[model samples]
Target: MPDTASDTTTGYQVLARRYRSKTFGEVVGQESIAETLERAIDRGRTAHAYLFCGTRGVGKTSMARIFAQALNVTDEQAEEVAVGDAILRGEDMDVVEIDGASNNGVQDARDLIANASIRPARSPFKIYIIDEVHMLSNAAFNALLKTMEEPPSHVKFILCTTEPHKVLPTIQSRCQRFDFRPISVARIAEHLTAVLGSESIEADEAVVLRVARLANGSMRDGLSILERVVAAADGRLDAALLERVLGVPPEDIVKDVASAIGAGDPAATLRAMATLLAEGLAPERALDGIAERFRLLLAARVCGDDPALLGTGSEESAALVEESSAFEAEQLVHMIALCDAAGGRVRVSASPRAILDAAVTRMALSERFARAASLLAGDVTVSSGATSKKKSLKVADSTRPTPPARPASPPVIESAPEAAPE
Candidate 1:
């Protein structure tokens, strides 16, 4: 449910709001938690307080509304989700939503404590949803502790927070806690595909996958990115169009940079860096992309090239495996480190391109050093043992002997020189 109060003034609804989950089944990527809550609802064993914890955009608040709706729905109104919609829109009187960030003072807590004893206005339960509950002051939490511990049978409390660690242990002990996990990229991509189908919008699969990756486990963010893409693209969504929209360097350009580093070509590495900068790709973002590829390659070497685990398409994973063969696992780890260091520096550096170029060049040189050292050491494979500490990989070449000792000519040379002087 969305706030329909201001759409006349704004004239539009964002996709995230328009397609918000209306039912438990519609909430993607949180099946386990949803099932648990639904079971609780069915059993009529609702907890007095629930602490919903997770990262932002993972629907802690939405789940709270769902629980509230399930608890308060009547026989006649079972078909209609108006109560749930009202709670979602923050317009319900009985289901009050308090922004802990704004009303986190002692007075606000006292007011809430006073109201906690009252019965519901319309529904069976009076639900108080506190968003970002960790923002509440110490005194405020203390004030609510008594009510939360022993509230009226008709009252329920739902507290949502991104930072659960900041919440007091005493408060948490009195509530049922559910930790929400981040949505996977594949789940998000499927949702995006369905959304595009609903809108009759044509988008390339690659573009959707890229958007999902960019979303980084947030469905709201993925929808927001899709909204921007839909607004920007008059026709179908394609790789080239998305690249421009996201300011991401082309995949080929990033691959070329990786290839150069793998093949130990410093000039090519710098050229790739220049191309990325010329394409208006941020240095930090470029480094991150490079680092991700290296990470995928390392994973391929260790984890057997599974696309799902790698979070890349089959073709891309194959390409990574092929490119990854150029350097040892140790070299890939070193490359990732260089990328991480350069990424940190580019954030504050005035000349980011220079820093990026240096980083890539350094990665290439590192490959050279690894190759040279391996050759000199008789193709020794450097690997860590059972412990985290590094172990020396020494390969002894018995054929390569120590050089013969020089003849003892020093005594004769000194005597001859003395005779000449005399």
Candidate 2:
């Protein structure tokens, strides 16, 4: 009989597993890592010690579990071990996962080494999954290193950690390392849709996408957000509920503001912001939303390989890259810093609109106006104030490759035109 744990009928299926990609074919993105691991398994060149490193919510732990499931198998009832099962049963005994923070002691390391000597009771080899191995104390690491160098031929070890630098260099040298990258927002969105559908949850795609973007490339985080949305959506998983629950501003709304800013329309930008405020959007959340989008745009613009990871549309991606090409990297860096500083203040300020407005005002003039002032002083002769002024340029919401010049708009003098030149 198949394991009773395989039951999918109940709502107990967490988003992580409901959306878990068991085989390499199912895992989206991370093609390079997957392909390399798959090849290692196929060729029997698998290393005795393996190090899987990446950020939390990425696939370090999941991939570790997958590797354990792949290289070690079992007889349904007995302790017989097999290889190449192609599926990892969640309850397999051959696979033991250790939480390093809780179990990082010399005693625990010794116990693991002792267990490593014993052959798989029913599977081909006993697989140990040590998560957050960097937390292991120096003594614990030393105890484990001896066994790691020459564990029994049938025994395999997989260590997953977010901070590989803390791991002893000797341990790192012993393992075949594969770096897992954060999942793209599109991939996370795609996964969320499949998981929500599997659970028969009634949620809008926009809501799901919002949670995915908030997850910030962590599949685990995305799932957690999905679970929250499922509970708070009250049977109608709309975008508003998701944002409210997460204390986040809607990505689309932020994109609209970015679009307005990119188009160099001060009136339109302020109008959109006002609409958001009128609709009861928190000023702090609003600025945070803008900050997130701008940061993502900065990343996408610099790294042209994956815009989807940045939650950027195809058209927007093109525009953003074009905008990014205008300034030296330092300009974007400074803009993000200013927005971040403003966001920090807005989060705590009673008047968030004022704070955000100050941020946007600074962004527009921080570099350009200063430079223009210098030029007017006859210190320089540069004529490209238009390019330097768009702190919001990286979002690329405009249709043109680059936004139109904004120097055409001048503040009204109010005074008569020099009183007919005196």
Candidate 3:
């Protein structure tokens, strides 16, 4: 499956290319659409133009390439290709893949238009697969529109883009639009398992999940991250080393921080910070990890009942989501904001430890910040609530109340010292 051989080039295929889906069957999370395309071709109802639309790493380009191969398919008696070795090769016959970002100009398109008049050189049909199709210039799109409106019977056009909304509706109307969904974590995990085992490299499931989680629903992005991790680890991976390499704050740290937050124990939270500092974790990174957890909690609350909508298939994250209800959404938002701001500052600060200390103190003590706001607003009810809370906590009455004026003690102490000097 790899394009590389010998020491001439890097042996590593790079996760995206190495694990690329050569066939519709290998495409994860797009089975229904793949089946539809297969049936369409089988039934001789295949459209001349197709638009594969989705976010990046969702297999838009890959599907376009596959369809292009399908147009020129000849290995089997079947009309469409089955993504075999021959189809995967994408030889210099009828199938062609072009980057739209660079070839979106009218001149380039005019060249394509000039060539469209010609018939397929050898294969059944000439297939033009254009990626990032939305990048085409207005003039180029206009030129494409004419061809798409009425193309030769032997030509097939496959347009792919992450931003299909930018594409002209005229072009869209002429094509069969297929939306590619983001790859699920389960799918990414499965692919990673196959790829890793093939390479004879063993890694923890949590490490793979972390790579997948950071990918943010992009299979290409996930693979890219996984490649980086593999390279950084020098072959074998340890959970702590992997987390450190990827800048992921450890899972235990996140859980501890969140649990401390739930219990409202500032000291316990500060102790957790100290433990991370002992582990050689930077204050800035620790803060970022804390922020990431709170962000996760925010997402958990949003997708309270729907695990699928969360776009993750991690059991730990699912458990985190279930346990996340103990904290209010506003609390997570508040902590996330604080951690983000603190992390930003800590990164630039010469004394990150001091900044971390102050940040934790700020978060812990900030609960009473609204008391001052309430006082200024002359809201008696809020002041009473504060007083009652302090009473419930058994803090001293003197400490709870606003401080009275410091009277004549200063003058008396100065006189006694002056008297001794005289």
Candidate 4:
């Protein structure tokens, strides 16, 4: 049987929509913003306009809907499920939800302004929730400015955008802006655990944590990933299933590449990288994995094996701590920087494989450069490892002429001249 949690008589609703935040308390990772809005409603200090800005899959749109429901639904009517449901579904007469991307013309703004003057049909206030507001055209924004500045007392506006910098400063100034931060990995993991429990899905802790890391700080994204895995699990979800389904590089492959780089073995590094590519991993993804591995190593070097900082399971953390011992913090930083630069180039390069290979090789050879730098800086004695004593570095100047065989015969004549002068 299909999972009843996601399937309904009407149809199947994706987990992102099915498990969306319905109340202020349900919103994850944006607790501060939720609290502020709730207080605003309780104190009757709600602003005429509110700007919710954050990355995709965060709680911006969800919060917008919840805030609208709070503004229009009274304590007595709150018990009436239909009223709250209609507003949440954007079907209420007093609450309007507009997609700024599609209807971003001047006429749309004029129509919105025209509708703003109408009082609420049943609720106390009429609220406009415009999503992706940054996508609205300049003329459309201009048309709404006057109304936004001096709208009727019964009208309220909630604007949400992933790219707030694209929004005009004038429009931004008219609204009370709230910035939503990316959810942390720990928070995402905890939320995913709860979601799995509710769905009656038994997922390994490692699998859940991997999904959370893959979500990259978006709760909605975390649900979507979990939903996909659950659909294919057939009531069984494990690390192996996740690897096959997601096609993500296995942890061992990434560890091998990291260990090779740390050992300064370019051949081994390339071999490990080839294995990853042979597994059908994209070059960009391979680079990302390598970079993330180095990041974990760096974190381990600096912070030890703290799970919170490393964002890995206990075994993975222990492995990272062990591997990080092979490299200094500075070497890891340089390796990460190399990966970052190569990441940008690989996207636009004609031969992305070559770029990735070059990055891997450079990372493997990074130790030589680090040693050279240390020797030049005279920070510490460097050894070639073949000798028991430290090796001294002597810099030769090519522009300066070498002293000829004059020193072989100069001592006898120089002593006689010095004695005569005295």
| Best of the candidates, TM-score | 4
Report, for every candidate in turn, its global Cα lDDT versus the true structure.
0.84, 0.72, 0.75, 0.87
Task: Assess candidate 3 and give its lDDT.
Answer: 0.75
Segments of candidate 1 deviating more than 4 angstroms:
1-11, 76-81, 371-422
Please report, as a residue range, the 10-residue window in candidate 1 with the lowest summed lDDT. Answer: 386-395
Expressed as tens digits, the lDDT of each residue in 1-422 for candidate 4 is: 23446465667788887778899999989999999999998998999999999998889988999999888888666556787888877888889999999999999999999989889988899999999999999999999999999999999999999999999999999999999999999999998887777778898888988898899889888888888889889776898888878888777899999999889999999999999899898888888888888888999999998988777789878878988999999988888898889989999999999999999998898866766677778544546574434443443344567778554544444445555565
TM-score for each of the candidates: 0.84, 0.70, 0.73, 0.88
- Report the lDDT tens digits of candidate 2 across residue range 1-422: 11222566654666566566666666666778878888988898888889989888787776777677767643453433333333254466678778999999999999888888878766777888888999999999999877889888888888999999999998999898888888888888887777766666777665766677778788888888788777666677886787678767665667667666555566667777776666567776677677676676677667863556556456666766765554445656776687778878877888877878766666655455667766566454335645432234334455557766678777777855555555
In angstroms, the error of model 1 at 310 is 2.7
Cα displacement (angstroms), candidate 2, residue 10, comes to 6.6
Q: Measured by C-alpha RMSD in angstroms, how accurate is candidate 3?
A: 14.5
Give the Cα-based TM-score of candidate 3 against the true structure.
Answer: 0.73
Which ranking of candidates, highest TM-score first? Answer: 4, 1, 3, 2
